[model samples]
Target: MGAMASRGFDHIDTWVFDLDNTLYPAHHDLWQQIDMRMKGYISALLGIAPEDAFVIQKDYYRRYGTSLRGLMIEHGIDADAFLDHVHDVDLSTLDQEPRLAQMIDALPGRKLVYTNGSERHARNVLARLGMEGQFDAVHDIVAGAFHPKPTAEAYQRFLASHEVNAGRAAMFEDLARNLEVPHELGMVTVLVTAPGEGEAVRESWELEGREARYVDHVTTDLTAFLEQLHLQR
Candidate 1:
């Protein structure tokens, strides 16, 4: 048992997974709660309607890697408060997926959760998925000093903190652009996303069309993907 072979993932010794949509399916609708909270926070901060705030929020997310970063830069808002408010969504929509847990357990190498969200949010999502303690670490936005994905510095800091060798690592994320830096850094990049999810929130920075050079693999079903690798291994 060595790996899927076709993907040439045999050399990957570090498996870094994104939380939220990557670890759990988009159908769970967990992101919707956070999305609502972000708009609410923005509306309150700017004294605008939720509808207007939503438009600005997404524009910020597109211009900046994260809406929080945009708020901090443009308005000098409190990052800690924004994080807490946006992540205060209910996790009732999420439930444990035993198959995913089993699949993650079978994978070889060190596993870690790398998210632009806060650790508290990651913990809630992981616990809801019954994946607590499975990952070696949860590197959140705070760990990256509030610099979110698609930002070179965040990736650099994460790799240094973990002492990770990018050449021997693989990153699984839902967004396409987030994988670009990883690919450039010599890490295999996998885009885990569905068409509906991609269309709903993916920004212009996300990979368009079929020429996904930065993405080494694409999978709609994370559990099945991992299972196939495990079987081949």
Candidate 2:
């Protein structure tokens, strides 16, 4: 069954997933809390009004791969300080969960986190989900590593460092653009759909002129998706 099933899919030996929206449901409104903190940081750093800073931060995040990266090149911003400032979120509102952890423990391949977020951000999310020990690897946004996702350069570097066989690895992410490179690289791509509270961000999921097929699968919830995947296909 393992051999035939493996062949049925694209020989999935490595499964890499995104951390943020892909790991937790949007209905939790965790991102909203985090966003406010990030905006606040931006305002304080640039000495601008909070509202104006939100626009500036988003603009830089869009124009460049990450706001910190843009800030690094343009303003000589301190990367560590920026990450510390932006990620200051209260996780007390979040409770530890074991639902997804079991599913991940059952998956039959090497698992890794390939995210543009820092290690601290990933750690917080994983711990909250009771999945702190699941992944075999976690990549962070630091020190000229890989270009970070949504860009070809970062994807290329990610695969290279992991020694990933694209034919055998699966890449899961919430961002459409980030998965596009993995799809083209022959990695199976899974898009985690927004559960709730993200209707306003729907347009952000679409990649312009992305025709035919780029995603192998899509799910509205992470743990639900993993539960199904664990079953015999």
Candidate 3:
């Protein structure tokens, strides 16, 4: 770990973690299911082919921060229905990580799950990981009024709702772009990376800028990172 990475959480009283890949290993392919569902939903909604829908999905995700957002803006799709459909994936593939649960529990102060997905999906994921009730609160797309992360407005709304001091907080996210706003807001930002490659869930553009100055830390294993913090404190 670098110097900043080692001591960055010393003053952090609030730990905000992104769901999906950030909480669980990306190799599990859980998000891949959601990604496919998203494409399917878009294809069915627009009466287009899957490949064509995929292009629009990625384009929307790149331009609007989320595909659902783009769909709403362009086609007036029902956000709730879209979220429900996309998140309806099998959690049986995910195994409970007791070590991760323990490490997260050991952290001091408030813990929160901030996700662009629905609260129901976040809860299901937590239950699958045996981490239910570990977080003080969950701020989902509904809570943010459909504004997703990487957007300054969404971050501001989250901070205001939680009464969190950005300087004393730390955020963990799988996507580098999602951490940009948190870093700019003075939160210690940790980019959680997964092993292997050729994952369709995350795009090449989404994984860009991993070495950006805004990212304070980067870790491939979230459990080990938290364990190190436990020892440091």
Candidate 4:
């Protein structure tokens, strides 16, 4: 680690992580399930073709930060039902990541999972990863009043609810766009990337501008990054 990365980690007392690809490797294709589900949900809700729904889904994601948020605003769809349907993904492929769990457990201070997903989904993912009880809390989309990450309001709500001081906090996320707000709030931001291009599951838009100034660090291997922090401490 460079001196800047080391210094950034030194002041962190609250570690916030994005649950999906950030916790588990993107190669697992878990988000692909959710992506398809979202398209299906939109198609059914809007009485549109799957192809058309795909366009609308990506549009809403870009405009509102989440497809759920877009549906709620544009069509007034039931957020709870939408979340349940989209997050009903099979986790059989996600094996227990004991090494990753141990690294997370060794991190100092309060740890949290802050996701655009539902709390139930976050918990389920954590359980599957063998990281149950490793976090202080799971702040989900509902907790932010349906506002998703990358939005200042959502992050503000998370900070207040968790009593976290942004100046002493660090956030880890796979989507670089989601880290902009946290970085602006004075938290150190880490972008978790896929191990290789062939393993990437995120959309191009999600990975755009990943090298932006808001990102303090970028690591393809989150376990190794956390282990490096442990060694530094």
Candidate 5:
């Protein structure tokens, strides 16, 4: 194994988890609502049909980190306003079916929430899912300078800000590319979401990652992943 790929699994003292689909299931159609809202925002801004706006919006999200980023750079829109619109999608759908509080309580060491969403959004989602008290730290997109996933620089920033020893840490993300730098940085990397879920959101299970590159392990469901965790040392 390469040097960066080895630090996470055995020697790490910390665990970093991605929020959004990694914590829940992407198949819940969470992105559908967000898509609708994004399309609405774009259509209102550019005077286009919602359908065409949606197509263009998807292109932006796929090309730039987020459609909001593209809008901010190209359309000169307010970042805060865009964030409010995109993240305001309905979250009432995230259920307690995964009941992860006990599993989190049973976790062995320091656990941190490293998400691309805003801190408030992360807090709300966690609260809605009954997992509000599980993590040691919460890092969000605003704090991270709007540079969310697949960016090695952001992960470096995350490590620097947290005073984390990357060599002694593990990171769990549903997005494959997000795990790349952590793996390269010697983190114990765990890919928490399954395949075929497209990468609509930052690291949503709906997206696909280049698993052959940096992924350490793969799990179809977070609940099942936690179940197997208890049996391990």
Candidate 6:
């Protein structure tokens, strides 16, 4: 939260967040479980080896924003089953981050989570983080009609449904590409960088913020970032 970063988010009235790596540190190792579950489900569904499934999963994620979306389009797979199986991985690794929760609570305006995952998954994560009731709403993939971030449709849907003034809002996400639409829509975009979680296209997908102009701010420490904003307030 340097002067520039603080000014970037100072006028935002709606705070949109991407869950997963954005809220919790990447070193927490929670996403590793989810990534494995996704690979397992893909392997079992397509009758392929884990290694092959891994390749397909990453490819689909890059091409369609989410593997489930790609599965639906290419294989006619049921979205619900995929979401359930992938997100059912253990959450025992996540610990309540009170300071992170405090940073969020202290922020002014409406808070919302717009994740590519399901409402159940979002709730579980929030509960684990001790911030379950903090959000004004949870806009999941279901709310996005199976479209994920980087999809203009999903962003439009979230804004319309929540009655958010995109120009007066800010979006914080772990993935750089996901911030593109938010930036185009006139929202301040913050990229939350985390450690390598070893996902399908993680390397290519993670660090694009450095070169992407859509990213207005970048921070590895989300709690500290938000805390600084709070202190400025």
- On lDDT, the leading prediction is 3
TM-score of candidate 4 versus the correct structure, residues matched by position? 0.95
Give the lowest summed-lDDT range of ten residues in model 4: 1-10
Per-residue C-alpha lDDT of model 3 across residues 1-233, encoded as one tens digit per residue: 33454436788999999998889988887888998999999999999999999999989999988898899999999998999899999999999999999999989999999999999999999999999978999999899998888899999999999999999999999899998889888999998987654445567888797889888898888998899888878
lDDT of 2: 0.72
> What is the Å distance of residue 82 in model 4 from its true position?
0.5
lDDT scores for all predictions? Answer: 0.86, 0.72, 0.90, 0.88, 0.74, 0.84
Candidate 1: list runs displaced more than 4 Å.
1-7, 195-210
lDDT of 1: 0.86
Using lDDT as the yardstick, the better of models 1 and 3 is: 3
Clashing pairs in 3: none
lDDT per residue as tens, model 4, 1-233 = 22244336887889999998889988887899999999999898889999999999999999999999998999999899999999999999999989989998888899999999999999999999999979999999999999998889999999999999999999999888988888888999898887664424556787686879888888888888888788878
Q: Where is model 6 more than 4 Å wrong at Cα? A: 1-7, 195-201
Q: In candidate 4, how many Å is residue 29 off?
A: 1.6
Cα lDDT tens digits for candidate 6, 1-233 = 32344337667889998898888877766677888898999999999999999899889988999888999999999888888888886788889989888888878899999899999999999999999877999999998889888989989999999999999998999888998988999999888876443445366555555557787887778888887777666
In the range 124-167, model 2's lDDT, one tens digit per residue, is: 87887788899988877862362567788887777777888988
Model 5 ranges with Cα > 4 A deviation: 1-8, 97-99, 194-210
TM-score of 2: 0.87
Mark the 10 consecutive residues where model 6 has the least summed lDDT: 1-10
Query: What would the per-residue lDDT of candidate 5 be over residues 23-129, giving only the tens digit for each residue?
Result: 87877666667678889999999999999998888777766666776776778888788778878967778887545667766677788899877788788888888
2 or 5, which is superior by lDDT?
5
Evaluated at residue 31, the lDDT of candidate 2 is 67
